[model samples]
Target: MPQFDSDPVFCSLLQGSSDSRGSFSIDMMDYSHSEQSYIRNSPVLVTVLHDKYGNSAQITDFAPRFKQYGRVFCPVMTIRQIKPLNGSPRICVRLRPIYEYGAAIPQITHGSNHVRYVGPDMILRLTTNYSINAILDEIPVVLDEGVTLILGPDETVPDSVTEVGQQFLNQTLDYWHDWTRSLAIPYEWQQEVIRAAITLKLNAFEDTGAIIAAMTTSIPESPDSGRNWDYRYCWLRDGYFVVSTLNRLGTTQTMEKYIRYLINISANSENNFLWPVYRINGMRNMEEQIVESLAGYRSMGPVRVGNQAAEQIQNDVYGDAILATAHVFFDERLEKPGDEVLFRILENLGEKAIEVYDKPDAGPWEFRATKRVHTYSSVMCWAACDRLARIAHHLGLDNRYEYWNSQAKDMHKLIYERSWNEKLNSFVGSFDGNELDASLLLLNELDFLEKNDPKFASTVDAIGEHLKEGNFLFRYIAKDDFGEPEYAFTICTFWYIDALTSLGRKQEARELFEELLSCANHLGLMSEHINPEDREMWGNYPQTYSMVGIINSAIRLSTSWSDAL
Candidate 1:
C-alpha cells in the first residue's frame, strides 16, 4: 500500500577537479559499458569503474532469489558488493531513502556496522562491511578490498555480509540459468527474446499471480498531451496477452498461475458481470484521484494514482478471461488441469458474453465518454462462445458444445451484418460507424475471419492506410474524449505485423519488425507509446502489452534452429 519512487543509494567519486570555491567539480564520467547486461546471464548487475590513474573497482548488485526446500524464496532485500581491482579507489556513499511518497523523512539510527531508517509503516536496515561512520556521515573512504552492503527489513542478517552476498549471488545465478535452460527460445534474437521474457516475468506479481500493466504512472503519451494514466494495477485484457504470449515460448508456469487469478476473479463476480480491470490483490475498486503533492512526469501535472477505466463496461474481458482459462484446460503440463467445476464457472462468463456481444461498451481503447458497439469487442464476444464450444467438445459434453456453438454462430452473423463497411471496403471500428481503428487488424487472429478472406485483407490494408505512421501504427486518427491521439500505441504495430505475416507478406513484416525492435531502449525494453515524430518513448515503462508484442513477433518471425543447422 505505500507507494513512492526514489533512488535508494547515490555514490560519488572523490577525485574530481576543484573549482575556485575549494569544492570538487561535479564532472560526469564517460560511461563505456552502457549495455544493461546481467552477471552470467543472471539477474545481477555488474559494473566496473576505472580512474585516469591505475585504480579500478567493481560493483555488483542483486536481489537474492533462489530455491529453498523445493520452493522459491525471494526476499525483499538487495545486496551490493564493491571490490578493489587495482590500486585504491576513493568514494563516498550517500544513503538516502524517502518514504510516504517523498513526504516523510526517515529517522536514521546506527550501531557499530549497520544503519536503520525507521519510517511510519516500515523500518529498513542497512548492514555493511565498510566503515559505519563513513557511510553514516557520507564521508570519503578508500576501497582497498572487497566489501558488501545488505539492505532489508529491520532484522539481523544472521551471517557475514560478504558470505551471505556471495551465497545469494551464486544461488540466484543458478536459478536464472536453470530457468533459461527450460525455455524454448527462438534461434535468432535469442538475447532479445530472453531479455523480454525476463522483463515479462518481472512484471508478474508472484504472490497473487496478478501481472501489472506497467511500473510507473502519469507518463504522457506525447509532450504536454495530458494523456497520462496510472498503469500499476492488473487488467484482465492485458493479462491474457502476457500469459498467451508466454505460453507460445513453452513457459507455462506463469500462465498456469495466471489462470488461477482469472478463475478467482470470474468465480467471485456478482451477477457474472466482470470488470475490465482490478487491483493487483484482486480488489474491484480502483478510484481515480490526482495527487496534488508531487509534480507530474515532466511537470505535466494531474498525477493520477488510480485508473477510471476500471468502472467502465468492457465486454471483451469476458472473452479475455475465458481465452486465458482455456489454456489451463488444454495444456497437459499443468499440475491442476481445468475441471468440470472450473468449466461451469467459465460458462457463466460465456453467458454474460452472449448478453453483451452486440451491446455498446467502452471498447478496448477505453474511451472516457463515448460508448459504441465495437467490432473488436463483438469479435471477442463471439470468441468466448466459440472457445467454450471447443472446450465443451474437448470435455465430451455434447449438449454444452452444441449450446455454445449455436450462440457463437448467431453472434458472428450479427457482427458481420452490422460492422462490415461496404463503402470503405473494410470493417470499421464500431457497428455502423465509418472510422478505422487499429484493433480491427485482429480480425484474422481472433478467427472471426480467415487469412484468405477478402474482407480480412482489405481491413488490414485499410487500417494501415488510415492509422499507420511510417512503421508505427496509431490506434486511431479519430477524435476521442482527449481529442485526437498524438502517439502510436506500441502493441498495435505488432498486431499489424502479425496480420501481414498471415497474409503472406513475410518480407515486409520482417522489415517492419526489425525497425520496431530498433525503437526499444538500449536495454531492449518498450513503453506504452512511441512518438512518431521524434522516435521518443512515452507512457509507462516496461509495459506488459509492449513486451508481449516483442515475444510474439520474435516467435513468429525467427528462423528455426534446425534450419540454421
Candidate 2:
C-alpha cells in the first residue's frame, strides 16, 4: 500500500460527536459561492469555499522558498492557512501519518504547540496554532479566527505560528517575482511561458542537479492499459531537453548544475557506459518493483516504485549526456566553465557513441522486448561527435577538432544512406525501416539536416501525412511492445508544431499550437499524454518533457518583443 493511502490530514467541519469519533458534514452551497486563484504568478494557491449556511473560509497553501543570506533557501516545509470569512465555522482536524509504504504506522506524540509523528527512518513535525488536544483527540474546534499549519522536519519552529507563516508566504511571493523578472520571455503568451518555466523549475532536484521526469509514478498512459511506469527518477534524455530549453530562455544556472550532474555521472562510470536513468542523488542502479498492496491510479493495479530503464541499453543516452554538458563549455555565465579535463571525459563518451551508432540496441522509445538501430539514436551518436568537434575547435585544439570532424562526417554519410528510404523520400524510424516517427521531425532542429534541404521538407510532409491526427501527433502508428498507443504523446505535438513552423507553415503551426495549449489543465499544467479528441491529460503529472514542449513552442512561435512593441 502507498503511504499516501492513509489520508495524512483531513480537516473538515464538525456536525456531531459520538464515542471517540466525530461526524463531519457541510451543507451544500445554496448560494453556490467558491473562488480559486494564485498569488500573482507564484505557486501559492488560495481557495475560498462557502456553504449554504453562510459559512465561508479561505484556505491558502504554498511551499516555502526564498533567498536567505546569499543562497536560495527552500526548506522541505509546506504552510497551509485556514481563515474564517463568514459565520461560525466549527471544524475538526484529523492527523494520520503512515510510514514505510503503509506497512507501518508511526507513533504519534505531541508537545504544547506542535505534534510529532516518529517513525523508524524519519520524523515529521506539524506545528500549528490550533488546540493540541483538539487535534490529538480528534475533537471539534471553533474556527472564529485564522489557523496556520506548518509541516516540516521534526525540529521546533522558533517563531510564533502567525509570524512565521506570514513571513514565509511574503518571502516566497517575492522570490518568485524576482525569478520571473530575470526571464527573457516571449512578447506574447508571457503568462504561459512563466508558468511553464516555474513548473520546470519545480521539477528540478537542485540538491543533485538532476531534473525528474515527473513527480508521479504508475499513472498509466491510458486507462487500464497496463502501460504504467514510475517516472520519479531522472532520465538523461529528458534532462537534456529540460536544460536545453532553460538555456534558451537565458536561465544558465540550471544548465550549469545539470552539466555538473552529467560530469559526476560520467566520472563514476567505470566501464564508460551510461545508464538511461538514475536516482536524483547520482546513484546508477534502480531496481524496479511493484507494490501489490496499494491500488494504482483509478484503482489500477501494479503501482511501480523504481524504474527498470536504468538497466536497459538505451544508446541515445550517450548523446544526451554530452549534449547537456556541452552547454557548460560555451556559456560564459557559468562560474567554473568546462576545462580540458571535462573535454577529455566527453571524448571518451564520444568514442562510445562512435562504437554503437549503427549497432542494434533499445531505441529512444525503450521497447522492452525489441532492439533496432533506431535512426534517432544514431543521429544522436552523430550529434555527440558533431558537438565534440565544435567544442574542440572552441578550445583551439586543431588536430583534435579535425579528428572528430572526420568521424562525424563519416557517421553522417552512413546514417543518411542507411536511414533514408528512396521510395518514401524521407528518413525512417530505424535504419532500413519504412515507418515514420515523430522523432524524425527533429532532423533540422538537431542540424542533422538543413531546413532548406528538400529531403527535410519531404520527411516533414510524410510525417504530417501519416502520423498527424487532427491537432495532435502520435509518437508512431506502428505497434510496439505495448501495442499501438491510444493517446497522443504531448511532446510529439510540440515537435510537429516546431517542424511546421520551420517549414514556413506559420499559420498552420500557430493554429495547431493554440489548440495544443488548450490541452493543459486549468492551472496551466500538462501531463505526458492527452486524448486528442477530448483533450484530457493522461500520463504522469507535471511531466518535465511536456512542460519543456510548452516553453520551446512559446519561444519558437511568439513574436519578438521589439517588433511587437
Query: Across residues 1-565, which tens digit of lDDT does each residue of candidate 1 receive?
Result: 2221221221011111221111111111332232234665566777677666656677788877889998888887888888877677766666766554444567999998799988788788889898989877767777878889888889897988889989999999898888877888989888778888888887887767888898777778887787878888899999988998888888898888888888788768899899999887787777887765445665665667689998999999999999988887799988898887889999999999999999999999999899999988899999999999999999999999999999999999999989999999999999999999899888888889999999999999999888999889999999998899999999999999999989999899999999999999867889999988888999988899999888888888888899978
Question: Residue by residue across 165-207, what tens digits does model 2's lDDT show?
Answer: 9999999999999888888899888888888988888888767
Please estimate how well model 2 matches the true structure, expressed as its whole-model Cα lDDT: 0.83
Candidate 1 C-alpha RMSD relative to the actual structure: 4.5
* Number of the predicted model whose lDDT against the real structure is largest: 2
lDDT of 1: 0.82
Lowest lDDT sum, 10 consecutive residues, model 2, at 11-20
Best by TM-score: 2
Listed in order, each prediction's TM-score against the native is 0.92, 0.93
Report RMSD for candidate 2. 4.3
